[model samples]
Target: MNIGFFNGEFIDINKAVIPIDERGHQFGDGVYEVVKTYHSVPLLLDEHLERFEKSATAIHIRLPYKKAELKSIIVEGIERAGLENAEVYFQVTRGIAPRNHLFPDVPPSFTLTVKPARKIAERNYESGVQTIIVEDDRWAKCHIKSLNLLPNILAKQNAVNSGNFEAIYEKDGFIAEGTSSNVFVVKNAVLYTTPLTSNILPGITREAILQIAKEEGIESKEERFTKDFLMNADEAFISSTSVEVLPIRTVDGQIIGSGNPGEMTKKLHQLFKGLC
Candidate 1:
């Protein structure tokens, strides 16, 4: 069984415990981050931790440990889990209390879990994935990476139920993001993604891609584009801890860029893999 860091101890997943009164369980008062690893080496850990701290502060939740200490714990957890490549899921939730909507007068609880890295299939990554556009009706605090994700869950499941890989969320004809990933498009030889706003999640992979673009001399723009623009793009892709630079061949059954992965996407995919 996978070992999990719950409360303060590393224990079997089956034995890991959480009080039913935990605010995360009752009111979803928490934030989380997912960090990707490759061949046992954590990637972009500092970036992820920076975001983790930001998320904690955004919700007024106090982290139980400092960033350095948490980093050690995450490294230890990865070692104990025996994962050469994996995704680490870490969260901090306001501690347990009696059933109530008010904040608990206690320190927040921290939990870190490691799982086998979920790698996209070779065919899916090569041939590209599919996405469906759904209305963006998520909470305004999406930039916080909070635990409240029912709206995203429903939207993502709706796409999955239709055999799609992701749900590109849109608001008033403009694309905000995916239910769980950052959406981007390539048009006229330039990369376009949503700007940093409360309307979208701040994705670590997205940042890494921007850095890669800068280093590789590829132009990028953080500008909001409409769903119609996405539909007309030469290529589209989504980024997340789990799905890194995942190409989208079709959106809502409409073919994207000759119904295959575009050239720029393949080049970026190769560049990201090289980074790993």
Candidate 2:
């Protein structure tokens, strides 16, 4: 079963509760976080909440609930969902108001939903996924996980239409990140990913992967790389809360490495799943 929460109440998932003037629905005025669960427990929720607060602050929208209350609500949502594995999505919006460009004086609106997690096919994990390099045409502050995702949606749809699974964004001749994931490269046994900057979301799974590499004595670097560097890398993958770690087989239709998932990629993903 799935669950829905709005304002201070939990309602039917299919209920028409939001008003027409809701800011999140009207202007995408919100910041959200998604947490994945395994064995009926939400993973790294504290870290996600920290980021969620940061995103809300960046957008000048103060959250209505404290950290403890937010966590309680999330756990309750998972229990109501009754799924071992779930995706918990929550957002804080600027609240309902009359049609105007200025900020409203109403209280912020908080909405949440818990649904069964989406699983990628085993074949994809084994064979790796296809990707394309697209110019980064989004706003400069991509670090915030805000609700304005028009550019991301467009790029992802374009990738799917072109028979690819993900879209990697290249900003100023260097790899920024994926439309919805963090880009990574393994070259000569060293893991390389973009550093924490204003143009990319600091993914929770990405930080987990880096910590895993450190614990496993695997060499890693947080540095920018070009498309050519990624194309020639021995292994490549994308990371996110939803995807965890997914291998990339090609870029712009060009085969990466031997056109297969590399040993390190598989090893890292195995180690990552251990955390779950």
Please, what is the whole-model Cα lDDT of each candidate in the order they appear? Answer: 0.88, 0.95
Residue 207 error, candidate 1, Å:
0.5
Clashing residue pairs in candidate 1 (N, C-alpha, C atoms within 3 angstroms): 40-84
Model 2 / residue 215 / CA error / Å = 0.9
Residues 1-276 of candidate 2: C-alpha lDDT, one tens digit per residue: 999999999989999998999999999999999999999899999999999999999999999999999999999999988999999999999999987889999999999999999998988888899999999999999999999999999999999999999999999999999999998899999999999999999999999999999999999999989999999999999999999989999999999999899988999999999999
Q: Which residue runs does candidate 1 get wrong by more than 4 Å? A: none
What is every candidate's alpha-carbon RMSD to the true fold? 1.1, 0.7
Quote the RMSD, in angstroms, for model 1.
1.1
- Rate residue 150 of model 2 by lDDT: 99
Full-model lDDT, candidate 2: 0.95
